[model samples]
Target: MQHLSILPILLPLFSGALLLLPPFSKTLKRQRLLAVLSMLLQVVIGFALVASVQFDGVTQYILGDWRPPYGIVLVADPMSSVMVCVTNFLAFGALCYATGYHDRTGGYFYPLFMFQVMGINGAFLTGDVFNLFVFFEVLLIASYALLIHGGGKHKTQATTHYVILNLAGSSVFLFGLGILYGTLGTLNIADMAQKVGDLEGSVAILAKIGALLLMVVFGMKAALLPLHFWLPKTYSSASAPVAAIFAVMTKVGIYSILRIHGVVFGDDAGELANVAQSWLWPLALLTVVIGTIGALASPTLKLLTANLVVLSAGTLMVCAALGNEAATSAALYYMVHSTLVAGGMFLLADMIARQRGKAEDRFVVAKTMDNPIFLGILFAIAAIAVIGMPPFSGFLGKVMILQAAHSTAEQLWVWPILLLSSLGALIALSRAGTTLFWRHSSSKQASDEKQTIHLGEWLGIVLLLGASPLLALFGGPISELTIDAAVFLHDPSLSVDALLTSPLADGGF
Candidate 1:
């Protein structure tokens, strides 16, 4: 079971490497088969890891038989394991969608996709702060390639800005790591958590600054206010599958904040306990406000979905800022709901674009689609789920967040902003849906061009969209898991003790 901790990272790494080799490299069919099989295996392995962690508690895999506070380790607790499971599930759906035409537009699409999954899994599983930085770079490098896979002037321009900003963020991340390591003397996260409360005077000041710098990097990754201007264009410009998979990338930042700030600098840390809460609360609220406005002003369905992603990020940040187990649990639930729904929305928008001829996904009247009823049904389901309507997991997720906020001082602020944002999202999405499906131009000539809808694409959309109802139906057990995970995260001793004292494993937990 301990060995399973590393498979999530390794499966994708080796699969991507193999996909770049001869037979797979020359044949798209072979590449698709390999990628799908790898992802299917990943989903199985991910669930196994989650189940093992749930049954056995925290499990750590020591590399080279080395011990913690010295050697590299991969730790699997409830939260990280669940995240891996969710990521693999989403990756599978996105890969299924991409096998249609998105993969054909560029070389190494399958390989790059696998590499991106490897990086994300590594980030979730790694127990060292420095290793987190390494995984961040891995994911970012792969994403840069994936974003421009189709090759267009607009994509090039978006990628250019995305690269510049992330490069700057990466530099800041390294500086923060240097300062933290210099002051703390160890980059192992469990070790850092143990030692953080012992610092004094100048060293403590430096550590605080370093911690906040890391927070800045995380906020940028989460697309918090003032740093979120690049997201809508970047996401809207990408191909459907790329955009769909990119939905989970922001949660990576949210996870980091929970792992580092929530655990390392938690209530137990002297002077640094909950250091990020003050700034996070206000900035998170502002992010919701601005993101809601952006969504309302969006002229295209894809752009609107991108803005909604920003809004969801802000909502998740609010939960993080609350600094309680309830909030954390709610954040986890909402995170999953938002990622799946937003991804479905992106794919649905792309389908609409394909059917609309020159009108694309823009909110404008165009010739009626070849299959309006079918596409309309998908769009409505996606819109209802994304807008937090009842019977869908999104509504339940938002309610959990609101309930978590109740009795807190920030409730007054959080309730208004979050509810208002939902209202805005509803208005914008309703307008887009009506414009695309209701108002039609009979005067325009019927389109001679028709894009083929692949079976894989339909299954992909169903799998992702279908998650909403499943999550809702099983909300009880899943919520219990998240609640336990949140409690586990708050108490760092469980992780530290497990990492430090667990006996060497020969494929047994």
Candidate 2:
């Protein structure tokens, strides 16, 4: 059981290293096979971990066999478990999609992709603040490489900007960490949480400053409002799988905020908590407005990228602003839904671009919508999910967030902003859907003989789309899980109680 805790991070790290070995250098087939196997292994491990949480509650593993406040700990609570499962699922799906795209890029794609997974898993599992920074850098570095994997002038330009901006953010992150270490005398999050309330005067002030600075650094990564200029261009320029993978990157930032705010600075005396609620609300609202406007104005697939980034920021901001159990759970739900929906859409965009055989005119009719019923249906479902239609996972998640927002004094602004943002997303998506699927073209539709989707691609799409319905069926349990997770975030003592008393069961009392 203890060994299971480290498997999530170690599996990918080992697989990634093996991919770089001499024997694997020439065999793309073997490399891909290994990548898929490694990813599936991780997914299975993630599910087992989540199930463990459901049974025994939150699980913590200390590195180097040392006790808390002294040694680094990796927590496998509901929140981290949820993120790990989602990240692994998407990693597998993206890898499947990349099977078709791999030949277009060189053999290096799989290695970098695996390393990215390593980073994401590490970020989700690490219990130390400084290790969080380390894993984030790991993911960002891999992403920078993957974004420009195609090596075109446009991709190069976008990657350069993306790399530089993120590098600056990374520097800010480290500086903040330094300040935090100096003030708290410990980098362990659990220790910081326990000690943060006792610090006074100058030390407390430095801690608050450090927290705010970390927020800025993460805000850039989350692409919140004014800090989001780099997202659209960079994502638009990258290949679809790259963009899909990058979708998980924002969640890293959100995870950082949730972990740090909910755990480290959640106490009443923490001045930074107050600042997050007051300042983050206005910033979130602005991001919602600007993101929607950008989507309404843009004519390309890139618009979706911008819109989703804004939506993600708004969702996280809601979590920061509300800082309640229900609100944090809602944010977690939204994070999972948004990442999956955005990833599916990116894959759809890639499929459409591939079918057209040209990137310049993405909507050029390659085959009649009727010919590929599966593709058309999947695309429609994805579009509906992104727009938050009823009976879908997206709708349920949004409702949860709205309900959380209603619990606050700022309900007036929250309701209006959410509605307006939903409206904007609907209009922009409707226009794009019309262009991509409904619009007529002069070219003749491809015959059944000429148009086909790989079995793997179909399977991936079906599995992901099927997840929405599964979420609907298990709404009770999943909601409970998210609520439990949120509760754990709000009060770690409850998590500690569960860990100490329970044997880890399927359902909690």
Segments of candidate 2 deviating more than 4 angstroms: 270-273, 359-372, 445-452, 495-509
The local distance difference test score of model 1 is 0.90
Q: Candidate 1: deviation at residue 136, Å?
A: 0.5
How much is 287 displaced in model 2, in angstroms?
A: 1.2
List of clashing residue pairs for candidate 2:
55-504, 55-505, 56-504, 56-505
lDDT of 2 at 233: 83
lDDT of 2 by residue, 1-509 (tens): 65677788889888989989968767888888998899999899989999987986566776765666566667788899989999999888878877775435855888899889989988998878888988998998899889989788999999999999989998999999999999989888777777777878888889888988898988888887688888888888888777777887888877888888777777544554554656678887888788888878776765575566667666667666777888888888878888877777777766665554433225334344433455577777876776677878878887887888755566887878887888888887777767766764556634433436665665555666667767766778889888888888787565333333334321222
lDDT of each: 0.90, 0.77
Please name the candidate that would achieve the greatest TM-score relative to the true structure: 1
- Model 2 residue 91 distance off true place after TM-score fit, in angstroms: 0.4
Residue pair clashes in candidate 1 = none
Candidate 1 is scored at a TM of: 0.98
RMSD to true structure for each model, in Å:
1.5, 3.5
